[model samples]
Target: MAFTTVPLTALGAAPWEPNTTYQTGDIVTYGTDTYQCVQGHTSLVGWEPPNVPALWSKQSSPADTQPPTAPADVIASNVTSSTVTLTWTASTDNVGVTGYDVYNGSAVAGSSATTSYTVTGLSASTAYTFTVKAKDAAGNVSAASAPVNVTTGAPVVDTEPPTAPNNLTAPTVTTSSVSLSWTASTDNIGVAGYDIYNGTTLAGSSNTTFYTVTGLTANTSYTFTVKAKDAAGNVSTASNALTVTTLPQNSTQYEIIGYFPSWAAYDSPSFTPSNIDSSKVTVINYAFLDICWNGRHGNPSQSPDNPNPNTWTCQNGDGTVNNAPNGSIVLGDSFTDGTADGGYNQLVKMRQLKNTNPNLKLFASVGGWTWSNQFSNTANDPVTRGNFATSAVNFLRQYQFDGIDIDWEYPNSIGVPCASGQTCQRTADKANYVLLLQTLRQALDTAGQQDGKHYYITIASSANSSFLADAGGTSNWLSNAAQYLDWINIMTYDYYGPWDAASGIVSPLYNDPANTNGNSQFNINSTVTNYLNKGLPANKLTIGEPFYGYGWKGCNAGPNNNGLYQSCSGEATGGSDGSTYDFAYMQNTGLLSADSTGKYTIAGQGYTRYWNSVTQTPFLYNPSTKIFITYDDEQSVHLKNEFIKTKGLRGAMFWELNADRNRTLQSIVSNDLPH
Candidate 1:
């Protein structure tokens, strides 16, 4: 064919690149002929503009004059009250179809590059017709597709309110606080939350089924009811009423104390003093301030023999030179000059929080599970005790601590790493412990006079009844120690652990008849009763609870106690060594859950929950996996708080605060105990 010379601009052809992708309708020039892309493909080295016919075709003219064919089979699916999804067969164009316009009646609702489009924000319960139009890159448009009719579902009326929460019960009632719980409500839709009422007044609201009512008058009778609520603002009828009378206000309001472990800074969650909820606890005990035999008060130097090299020890004492007055408060990590050490620098953060909570007190707790090896050497003699007491006062003042908590694991019992040459668990530990407290009290009082403030002193005593008799032969150590101490934090947990051949509840509030292992006397009630009977004032005793639980693996599954108190071959994966799994770890990992039936379950972990009425505790067992887990949940914690109020005890204390899941267990302690 004969043709006149035409310029590249007249042909509407642009230069092509080897790396660029060209779709249909894109015209490119090679030599003199104008070529259009017949398919969407990337330009290759060999597949030049004139080399590939399937990808590129010679065009008579570069301008696209044809429009896309009309779409077909338009339909709508997945329709909702406010939205509808529309889909149609894709339209075809001589060139390339660029986009599609979706229309509601005659108005353009929206546009999309694909055949499927979703129309949103439509009025519910209304019928609507939708159509689509396809457009090419050259601005040519196709005819409208077939109309698709769709009527959105009725506006979810949500007229049916949730069923009322049932089994309203008061788990703990104190002079000024009460903890309540009920079975969750049912609804056509999911329930949102619950509202608690005192008589006819709304007391509080909780997302969960449980609520704690605070600021109530002491010794007053109050009736409570719970009502369920839905997202649509629908409220259910009131639950069964529960009437409870608060206990008489004691001379001194009970205290809720929690220990903040120094090593928690190294954990996965890295708990710091800033993580502490000051409102939930009256005192935060900084755990394990070590005592050196050389008259120094600080953390122990690293040792090769010990598994945890940073653990405190009492070796190599130099009595000639006194390191007492110059003892330093060692944190997890040290600062070089003026740098922050993250959570490890808890002392600085805790001091800052003190201004926010004036009622919250901070105490330095000396000696714990691993560090109690030196307690005997420090407290056995009058000279060492005097030196320790003097250094303790100096340490507390230097750290800006308001008080001291001596957590001597036991007086006459062997603890971890009782070195052969060290004097640990001596027969005279009980008498010496008393003497040490007396000395500390005198020193603290002297320091308090100088500082013009009363510095409190407390102790974490053993729950074992034989502890006193083992420490002192016929000596009333509990009575004698009470004179100098502000309160005694009874270690009521760790009654049973994986060390035993069988799995058992770690912290039962009451004795269990299923415990045939002669562990009936190791419960919280029995232990508290023993201390009270042995001349310990109820007002000066704070029952200790555990924030973690123990587990066992390869256990014998028996129907008698639902695998509880059954022999186990070995320890479980998470809680093998008494405190392997913290409450936060379990709850966050979905390893545990509490149902409305008052039973706790190991969710998806091949275990079933069983509740023991005698012990008022819950246990888990799995026959296939042969795993047994004994742990305390919100229900058990509430019951323990009730026990404390009933006994008129000082209050409650937890072993470590970081172990709790979202401050759930601590909330129970705070709301159930007297403020």
Candidate 2:
């Protein structure tokens, strides 16, 4: 009876349902296609008929054969040693442009659903010609776009070799390995490496002048020569050979963990993945991946802030809703973690160069001070915790990270309360924190087992002992969770800032006697001791230092200890935040300088820099403006490194690689740590 008024069936195929398995030749209609299943499989959002041709075949050719107009204004950007990112104006079609195909010469280099595409697997120092063509849903292709030529980068042909290494000496000799050191060699385009030879045979190589040659006979004498080499493979004459007898075996390398923030890539004169010198760091913690909930992310205390920003979505990398389980981790900023040319891709590029930096482990640092709001919710429940763990493993595998760093602000209690008296913290966070880590550890182990790669886990903790203890609510939860972590990044700075009414050290190596205020117990030494006393191993702790400083204003000079612990009338609200400034910013703003004696001072800004004997920190006090800044210099940074060794702690961790000036602090770290 209903057949009289029924409309004709289109393709006579029903839509595919999620998780529904279909046999080969089974038909389903979705979007513009009546697709026949070519492979028996269940359906998922990303596996739609149009997306996976191996599983489903389009049943008919497009009715509209008219192609889209050729794409215009082809442009290439973010070209690297092996990757070229392309962008072009959209093409018009009588129906519509379903996608675009990018061509390298005559071959199809890549395809994209949008106008932009990244042509990867290119060669270094090579030229590539790329053309883009538009396509309609009917598979009709448009004419090729105007070709864009892109050239990759690197040190060009170098006939000149690096200066020969000098003063070669055996620092430590073992039964199987000999640790050798020598004066660094000079190069025309920066020394790429040093080749160490046993007699006439190449035994091993090192990026640094120092390297440990292994696999020698025990108690045997070996003669070794060192030659400087450049990126162009040009090698210098061998140095005077040195002979040494082997002893018993031994080795150790303190982790030089540097926090490489995703936001750092957004800086002008940006630092990308290629900019990362693997030799400088043992571990790079890529920071602030967030937990998605309520479809919003927390802001880092900035205003006019996220408006018109990039990568603000809580979606997966493809700009699709994660649609995974609840409380899972998502890319913090997909724009910065772009599909082609952003930090995420850059990190992956770095990962692809594993052979170049065999020891450089990149860890994804999640839930920084601001974005940690959702962590409590994610960790509190088993379902969310399960989702968090699996999502984290997927992200690690997807992004090619070697580890994960949990930076939950005040895990269960006691820090960074939300605005207007809102509380993101929960009492349940204490026990849940350990469970969360346990889940992560198990998941990491399972994934690592499947891939035969060991993935690490770490926690970024407050350097304050009280915060560490108070967080657990008498349970000492952190100690319980330590068994699952590779190390703890103790944020040994931010003890005091402009936020404090009184001017104090930014991060003191020892407790400041003048710190009579609330955070009086804060200091690097006490924080490390607290962990040790709580039965946490010192070797599993990394002292987190700052590559930045904190400033306080309306301060008093003379007898006020040059603004140390001086009562500040106000704060230095002129920086990125009200209190923080990078070491570069201080010098750039002329707030820090050198005097006639080559001593660092703020005298140009009417301020005198002073060093605190008790805190082992530097401070700047302006008599006129009454501005006070407590910052770390090379001397202070070195002192902290010495502290790391003195306490037998794991290593040194900096708040950022971005804040270092001229790699000054970085060089200090390399020199200070056990090579």
Please give the clash total of every predicted structure, in order. Answer: 0, 2
What value of lDDT does candidate 2 attain over all alpha carbons? Answer: 0.72
Distance (Å) between predicted and true CA of 556, model 1? 0.6
In angstroms, the error of model 2 at 429 is 0.7
Model 1 RMSD, rounded to 1 decimal = 35.6
The regions of model 2 sitting more than 4 angstroms off are 1-251, 294-296, 299-313, 340-344, 352-355, 418-423, 470-474, 558-561, 576-578, 594-603
What lDDT, from 0 to 1, does candidate 1 have? 0.71
lDDT of each: 0.71, 0.72
- Please write out the lDDT profile of model 2 over residues 1-675, one tens digit for every residue: 111211113334687655565655577878765776644555544566654443555563425768889999999998867788899999998865646788999998855655687777788899889999987644688999999999997635679998889999875454555657788899867787889999999876666555656556667889999999886789999998899988743225688988877655545566666666668789988876887653544442212221111113366655566544446787765545555222245555657546677878988888776577667767766666888889888988887788999888776653555432123567667677887887777677667758878678899988766556645354666766765677788898888877778887889888766667646568888878888888676767899889898878888664754766778877687654456778767767777675675445444567677788888878777777778888897778889988888887778888787787456678878888865
Off by over 4 Å in 1: 1-252, 295-343, 470-474, 576-579, 594-602
Model 2 poorest ten-residue lDDT run: 302-311
Residue 271, model 2: lDDT of 60
